[model samples]
Target: MRRCGPAAYPQPIRRCASCADGDRSLRTVTGIFLALGIGAATGLGLTAASVGRGTGAGVLHIGPWLATPKAGTTEADPYARAVTARLGTLPLALADGLALTAEADDGGQRLDGRCTYRVSGQMPPARFWTLGVVGEDYEPAAPAGQRRAFTSYEVLRQADLPIDVVIAATARPGNWLPSGGAAQIRLILRLYDTPIATTISTSTGLPAITRVACS
Candidate 1:
């Protein structure tokens, strides 16, 4: 009878091969999971960045301030609509009003609650206007029972001068809006029954924000 030396170890050899295949399969599964994890993390990061960026294809920039003229109308881009929906706030239609927001000063520095700012300049003609510090998502960021917002009638502007408003954690004379000691702030201006939503390109009168001091 043949010794069958090599074949005698057939069982062990087959086991070894099986083990090798199992290892490779495990590695493949791990690689697939890693790829999926990386893709998910990247996607989430992009979405978060897009939300706070406050921008869309129809963005309007005046100095460091920015606005989306069609953000509230049916003409709003997909990104704008998604953002508003996520914020759970309803935007007025173009026929009703135009809205603008500024998160930075004219010098292009992000507005800090620790610092004081002055918003001044000529504004477009509107039947009514309101200015105030809103939350990151444009929600009212004031203490309940306190001043929730400011309207054109509420601001005390200097006669014979352009509109000037002070934003600070502390109070100051003339058109003052408290910053509420938050880390960051955003300014929103709404113009009711204004043509600037469609005529911004030719509208020269716009507001400017100037950083005054910091704590």
Candidate 2:
């Protein structure tokens, strides 16, 4: 027989090389799948966060307040529609009325029920207006048998002076609005038959909410 050495084992060596190539191909496929899965999850998470923050396009910023002019109307944006559906609350149309809401004080501090706030400023010109405190769920907040809302007709205003309304869990002296022991509070200022809706580019003269104290 001819002298056969390493060449006699050529078949075994070829089989090992094929096995290595197969393993590398499987690893590459697995890595691609993992990358795709991670990308999809990250995209979904960001979308949910944006919706929760309510930071949508075409929002009207009046001082420290925010409003969607097209909300609850035939021209409502997708974000406005989502918000209405989620909150299950009716929003006034631009023609009939406008609703402005604030979740933070004038100083950009988040409104907390444990803290007291003083809302004071020149009232926007309107036929009728109402200011109310509501919980996160948009329901009226009545704490300790206190009222949740105050109307422009009822709030005491001094001539040539701005209106002042106090928001607290306890009783306040003038224009008292209760927080109802809620962890978070939202101030809704609704203006009915207001010219402000027509001239949104101009300053709305909306009131400011200032934090006074926290217990």
Candidate 3:
């Protein structure tokens, strides 16, 4: 056998100390970039979620309902403005009306679409009002297609009695706003030309959501 020192083959095997160090450096750089990309994505996701669901820390907290009274005006908070822009919501003016969002029932349970709910009680003083399940909050477009609402004018009511609205996927007796078979849903109460628009302090009261049954 012939004695061979370093050059055994024709080409030189480049496994020097510097080469190992360079490979380690490349790996470190790649890991850092990957970390940065993941962090960026996470941050953006959090921001979108935050904008989609405004926190109660900055807006009104009426039991389970939440709202930004000044969201339609220039005086709206930055977060509210961001939310409005993202949702593409044309909120009613502060002088015209106010909108309240309810994500949970009176028992502090998240409003599930598969279950039936009863919205009862007197509404704030307003010239006109509407109650319906909106698309954004939990966006219920799964089991139902036609999006509809119950208006104060058309909703069946007895002689000056408190109204009872039913939220369910199937048909109901009186006032029925479709909830579809969605996993979750949001109830929006819009009062047009309401006293609560101006005097939110004496906001009469909001409706109560009680879970009736589940399918």
Candidate 4:
């Protein structure tokens, strides 16, 4: 009988270089696909978020107020159309009215319920105009008893002086409009039967919102 030595044991099977390289290549390909998929998902999420916030193109800025000139017209952009659809609010046609909105105070800080603001300015010629405080949801910030709006006909103004309206969560002494406990607020200035052009111009007069105090 032949004596069995260490060399007689079967040598362990070793992987070929080609097979090892193929495995590494497959892993690299899988990693690339995963990275691409993650990137695509992140991009989609950011786009959706921007649209929801109304960060659309083609916005017109007149002073501190902003409006989409084509919002209520046949030439409305996709973002304007989407906003109108989502809010379900009827935008005034160019011929009937002009609506301007402000979300920040003159200091460039967001309008907050915790702060009092004074909206003061002179409006251009218009048959009628109304200024009101609305919540972030575009609804009346306060109940009717709280006086949410001020109309040109009812507001007190001095000769050749700008009108002033105060907005606060609590009662103020003059021209008070309630904030309705909302953390964030927006101001809407609607001019009805106005001759102002649909396009915003530097001469367009809009109100200035100045922060007075905060709680």
Alpha-carbon TM-score of each model against the true structure: 0.79, 0.80, 0.73, 0.77
For model 4, which pairs clash?
Answer: none
The list of candidate 1 runs beyond 4 A from truth reads 1-37, 158-160, 201-204
How many residue pairs clash (N, CA or C atoms closer than 3 angstroms) in each of the candidate models, in the order given? 0, 0, 0, 0
Top candidate when judged by TM-score against the true structure: 2
Tell me the tens digit of each residue's lDDT in model 2 across 1-215: 88888777755535678899999999999999999999999977876665555577656766568888888578888777776776687889787888888888888888898899999988878888999998888888775466878897888988768889999988888788888768898899999998877676536577888999998
Worst 10 residues of 1 by lDDT: 6-15
lDDT of 1 by residue, 70-98 (tens): 77877888777766777677787888888
Candidate number with the higher lDDT (3 or 4): 4
Model 2 regions more than 4 Å off: 1-40
Error of 3 at 57 (Å): 5.2
TM-score of 2: 0.80
Which residue pairs come into collision in candidate 1?
Answer: none
RMSD of each: 3.8, 3.6, 4.8, 3.6
The Cα local distance difference test for each model comes to: 0.78, 0.82, 0.80, 0.82
